[model samples]
Target: MAKISINLATGSLQQEEIIVGIDLGTTNSLVAYINPEKNPQVINDMGRGILVPSIVHFNEKGDALVGNEAKEFLTTDPENTIFSVKRLLGRSYNDVAAHQDTFSYKVIDDDKESLVKIKAGNRFYTPIELSAEILKELKSRAEHSLKTPVNRAVITVPAYFNDSQRQATRDAGKLAGLDVLRIVNEPTAASLAYGIGLDPSEHKTIAVYDLGGGTFDVSILAIQNGIFEVLATNGNTFLGGDDFDRAIVHYWIESNKLKEAELQANPGLMQQLRLKAEEAKIALTTQNIYNEKLGDIWCSITRITFQELIKVRVQETLDSCKQALKDAKLKTTAIDEVVLVGGSTRTPYVKQQVADFFGRQPHDQINPDEVVALGAAIQADILAGNRSDILLLDVTPLSLGIETMGGLMDVIIPRNAKIPTKAGRQYTTSIDGQVNMKISIFQGERDLVKENRKLAEFDLKGIPAMPAGFPKVDINFLLNADGILTVQAVELRSGVKQEIEITPAYGLTDDVVEKMLVDSITYAKSDVAQRMLIEAKSEGEQLVYTVERFISKNGQVLDEEETKITLVHIEALKAALQDGDKDLILKKADDLNEFTRPFAERLMDLAVSKAMKGKSVD
Candidate 1:
């Protein structure tokens, strides 16, 4: 055998290829790469254009449909369509199962795998599997668009995603056969995006208000000399555009005298209403009022009306923003510029709210949807050793700690501490004859262990038995550049190292991720396709069912021609569903919904009447 040669410097035997950056989101995903000229650019796939909707549809043929194609099937196959997989990444089944009602997909319980299974036709899938499909689709798009086989990438996650969720996101990338070099926070990535066009000498404090499809994040940063430091950050993992859509849907149902259960049962109608609501929200940005005709349902909404409806939700965002600024020890006036990130910020009402809160107009120069991805690409370039001039110093979003006496949390690393930082704490045996000491680590702002999120727990073993308070254990916690924590323990007297295994309290383990990947690949083809067919069939059934029910309940409210047109569109949708054609199913669904414009209007009127009567009664 030839002698092996090892190079210790740089920890590489040979030069590595350049890396890319990916934004794997709840509602959409995008891939960007640094070109040879050193500029970052997003790679657009042929079929799906630029941004891929983070929706996966398992069709009848067991094929997985991703992006817009999959989103189109959500209404028809609500049971099999999986969106917002990001929320489930690295999370336990129990953690996400409680919020199943918030999603449009069917989440089945799987005790054996400790996974949340998504039901699609005859098959079931774990959250990791669904996320892997989206990741794979993104990988394919990046490779095809770049015309090169890309291997290395930097992926972004929510700042508030627990250690388990972060690990899950990394596992998804691994399952998709991509090497994730680092996992950056979404808001930090947005800051990087803004830094690209900005002057480093500005040395100003910037606030990023990022409200995306399924999450909201607010981060305050201080920039100077090409150094970007995240001072503080806060967000709700379960809040975003989805919530706004739900808020509007609630308003419509109450205004039209529609039953909540009826809306829930009819996925097609829900889709229609969500789509209309989203349109109205966008329209309110530039126009004061807009009219929507959904089949026999016709309704008009003004900007003021939309503002009043979402005022509470908007206020919540403001509150979080204020809290983030407070945590950073800065006031609104201290912020030099407020950059808005995320698609949901396109709403004029949201812009106005942000402006009023900050006492200044929000910046809208950059594309909200693309900014985060662009920033991620820049970070990828830095990791690829292409941009040594720039450096990013991000902070921990939550405090890391352990449980102490009285169930109180003893904080180790306080939140907002700079990354690649280390802290050590010394502990002594509490009882006589103690041979092992367990350290439970928690992350969150809460003072109690039960209130905060438990990040991990590890035991330091192989300790000599000692009298009470005699044994000394030194524990060191280090957060790396990726924001993941690592711990080490050393016995003071013996100078011996103890085994330390971190068990995340809320995140999935590596073993679980591997199993999920295997399962997803095993049923990748047929399960996805079958799930799609089921969704299409379901949408068709729902549209026809809702239309029929509406006609039966309010037939006298519509004229003869209006009734005939509505019936014709319903028949068309029913026929399309029978033939199992997705395109036809969608077209007819839209047409029939349009024909019922008058009925929809009457329904809103009835809902308003009921609300007014309830108020009087109260």
Candidate 2:
């Protein structure tokens, strides 16, 4: 008989490859893998801990420090340290501007429909890049513990996350050098962790109540024949375990008659109190009382007092549960299990309230903090072709997006998008007097586009020479049942059009597609940086062409110094282009554009005046 080793976690055959699962959370994150004993375990190397704080610190030299090492900087150097960046992923400036004061870091308010950027010292970073730092930390931990090349993973995200947000998570994974095979929902992963859906013949309907550090959500899941389907999901992104900590602080402030402005003025003191409140919250989970103080500030609370402070917040979760049940159209009696997840579930009040609401004892057998990660490991194992009992659905393993301004990718069709599905969004130019737009299609899971598997590239030409953003370009990607993808772009205003048909996975064996996807992530960071440099070079070449043409035609219109400076700046840009540095190219491009902009505008004015010089009025 031939020997065959089975990974019980994923029900898949164990090969040389290892696919771990990652629980990338708002408050904390953890990595998990199936042990040799077949039980899934969270990695805790050198007792650093299972849960790594999702905090990042930027040193004076701008080197990023992540997780526990960076947590202390939240109070000391809040401006350069960022936490809860999950909230900012895929979010535009307008999406978070109202609460800008909440962040100690400088979240750039560009005041437009563009992705937000964080300015850490002199450098600007997008949320995708910052998130990569955290994932990189987790990846290092996994590699260190396993002593192997841990390149592939299955990461979980909030069920309510939109397509863009999900793409952003995949991108972060890629940037961190992980081939994210799948993006599982947090609730589904939690249910898997508790061993709810492993038995294909067993059927059950469960509600997963996930109350993490910064968010709370309830999901009603129906499990049938090894398939877990989410019937409905509901929650408030603004409510979670962090609110409990804040509740204690709010109660203390009210009872002590402390001024909100005073607390606002003293961020250091406020941060101290917040951490103390968090300690009190955790301590009250097992004990009835917790007491502490910082100088004159009294941070003391009993379990009963803590329950009162969180009463409303707990009720809010229950309400969301009711709504989820209603949306799922299932009665409480129909639920076979209630799974508790998230670090906040340790609170006694939460467990009791959830049990009462469901009329059954919620499952807390698994460690709530680690359940999602364990579930993810199981999913990863399944992806490795280990599991035979589970029925899997076919999906496009990666996201599809078009390269947009600044080398960023805008996902039109997200990863796991059902096959034969078509999705698209409109876009416009980024510069004034722009006449054409280049649409480059890519297949990958990263936000920073590594569109090396570019399906096709073509220009939508003949756009009216108007101000930036004047033209409406609608790019549509249609994938057929046979896996042929036709990417089409049309300028609605001017009817300028172009498109190309390509088989994204054309004639390639399943193994080939899988390898390409893995390689895309393994080199995602370097790929994106190289793509940026190429883009800069292309733009520099285009500028050179345009400037030379303009100077030749209008040499008689310019003064001697005007002509001299323009030629000099143009030469400098050409030199920078040859140096092959993206940043240098962009700087030279901007400088050249700034100097030439007024001249171009002046030319336009002159043409308009010449046309109307002798025309009658009115």
lDDT of 2 by residue, 44-108 (tens): 97889999999999999999999988998888898999998999998988888887887889886
Which residue ranges in model 1 land beyond 4 Å of their true spot?
Answer: 1-18, 35-38, 60-62, 104-124, 196-203, 224-229, 250-267, 391-459, 462-618
Model 1 Cα lDDT, one tens digit per residue, 483-573: 6677777889777565343433245433333343233334434433444455446545755776787799778778898889888888788
**What TM-score would each prediction reach against the true structure?**
0.63, 0.77
Candidate 2 error regions (>4 Å): 1-15, 201-204, 253-268, 292-298, 326-334, 397-423, 429-482, 486-505, 509-522, 531-618
lDDT of 1: 0.70
Candidate 2: C-alpha RMSD to true structure equals: 7.3
* Each model's lDDT: 0.70, 0.81
Q: Can you give the lDDT of residue 517 in candidate 1? A: 28
lDDT at position 513, candidate 1? 32
